[model samples]
Target chain A: MSARATTRPGGRSARVQQSVHQAVRDLEAEVGRDALTVPLIAARAGVTPSTVYRRWGDLRELLSDVAVERLRPDTAPADHGGLRADLEAWAAQFAEEMSSTAGRTYIRDALLGDPGQGNAVRCSDYAVEQLKAIGVRAAGRGEAVPDVETLLDVLVAPLMYRILFRPSDLSTVYTDHLVAAALGRGPATPQTKS
Target chain B: MSARATTRPGGRSARVQQSVHQAVRDLEAEVGRDALTVPLIAARAGVTPSTVYRRWGDLRELLSDVAVERLRPDTAPADHGGLRADLEAWAAQFAEEMSSTAGRTYIRDALLGDPGQGNAVRCSDYAVEQLKAIGVRAAGRGEAVPDVETLLDVLVAPLMYRILFRPSDLSTVYTDHLVAAALGRGPATPQTKS
Candidate 1:
């Protein structure tokens, strides 16, 4: 992101940018992602079509800008003083985010390279990187296995897999199980060291 | 799934069915999955257009039947007694199957619901069900955690996500990561923990 990313050519003020952004967002809510056109975005923004095109080359570029703008740092999981709590909170939150209506829609459409935009992969990569960091944190604390990254995925991937591909019901029990598994406690009660 | 699934009304043997399937497979291999079509399939089958329509209704239906027909139950992940060994063998085999030229094209197109076939979702559902059974086996003698299913997703989703979305080197390392995660082993390590 260059400093000039959001700024218009003629020194447009923050106020004007906000107006345009708000209009784009309003159109997104009404028409969903597929129906969003530059003309419509301009009309909603109360600007000329030329202005919209000048600001962004195409719809894909505009969407990409929105993703970059909206990307934020993840809040760290609470210090549960134990790997289980930290991991459980992280897995549940990860599952919830991926399963959200918007998340699923973004992911589903993104998989197809629709509109020639690359936001889906970018966003998912960002999340995966964050999860890796969290795994590293847990490992550093000695509360988790050394290969916490792989362990974390094992503990969390089911929710994401089901969220994107399967029909598994996401429940509180599921969240707990994910937590337990991350802590080296098996998902099911075993007779111990078979 | 019936005997009639093969052969034409005009005394054509099931060999025609196999030939048509082989044609679809060849066309897919040559032109890639994104380019598969009804006419091409018929041409490959060495039959008149009417033959295909009568047998499978539309291109979508034809493709659906082809997909079902190609799915060899014995060819999927094997049952190797233990979760880790089974998953290791399965992941290696499954990855090879999916990453192959034909496998990639088919799964990618299937996900896109190409040919307008409604059975795409069903195919994905069936694979996930198979995955769930694999997960159940991972539980081995343990039964305490209920979200074991989500764990399954976490392990598998990343593999699909990486394969479908990114153009990175699909090395044995990534496969091992996915296989280990799916089996509830620590990250980056082959299924070390039982």
Candidate 2:
């Protein structure tokens, strides 16, 4: 049996995990990542220092968990009957999440900190999984699915770049263009809808 | 006349400016941005700390100048006979520069350090100018130049995203695809070249 299986579902252990994770995000938003400490996180979480230390070994480990949790999409990409609609929905959702306060903090830490860290790798993998689902759906319809890397380059990466370097509202118009480009349908039309 | 016009071309002042800029890049490569300091940079450049202070006034100013110089493409996107070739060449050069040690360091500092700073703004403007040149060239060729913002979203932003988040060799095939997508030509073929 797995270690996770030992814990009862929605029990005190789960409550504590949820609280601690929330505390980490709250503290990070308040103080920024550079000034955050284990003791600070413990105090904020209403947990003991020993508990924080034993559970997470170091600040990096704890941050990685918190970051990945916040960075992951709130819901999986929906199958919207066609590849274009599915991709547009996914892109729009991804863009919205990344523009949130928690998302921005997580991304900044992931990029500026060690690139080979668990958090960075986890985030990349998470994005790939989402893209893979879209590609699979596209293939099911017999539409030519763009390679995962190209999909990332044309659609996801640009939105992410804007999130970091250029702060702007992630519009439907922009996401549609990205989707169209990825699908090899050329630039999106003005009337393209999600 | 501007303050810049007062300095004789290729004189001692120019020599000092060049040496100091080179020193900043070399120091950043050796110790990374977080560890860098004015005294150390001045020493490396063989200029007195007072001289460094008197001219640039601070580390951020000095770093900004160095970064803008390195980040700016050595030459504007050449005509290359067609819009696709010109864009491919521009993207390739941009990707190569951002992959270099100095380019990586500059970008890290720009993103992590105060996002509202002059350095980040200057770099963004530099990129816009290069994109504008390509658009103007396309217009000259009687082709539809994608809107400047779309050009950035499709062509430039993805490459910047890759340079930071994913440290792979920036492929020519990838850049050509970006250009094709920007021009509304569709996904690039395997044989796509500059």
DockQ of each: 0.26, 0.34
Model 2 CAPRI quality: acceptable
Error (Å) of candidate 1 at residue B47 is 15
- Tens-digit lDDT string for candidate 2 (A1-194): 00011123787667667767777767766987678898888888789888877876777667766666667655567989888899998888888777776667677656655545456656777788988988888898898787777777778787887777665557887788778777776564343221
* Highest DockQ against the true fold, candidate: 2
For model 2, give the TM-score of chain B.
0.70
**Count of residue pairs whose backbone atoms collide, per candidate:** 13, 0
Task: Encode model 1's per-residue lDDT on A73-142: one tens digit a residue.
Answer: 3454556665666667666666666666755544544454433325545655555565666666767886
**How well docked is model 1, in DockQ terms?**
0.26
RMSD in order of candidates: 8.0, 6.9
In candidate 2, what are the lDDT values of residues B45-98, reduced to their tens digit?
Answer: 899999988988788667756655665555567778777788888888787777
lDDT scores of the candidates, listed in order: 0.57, 0.71
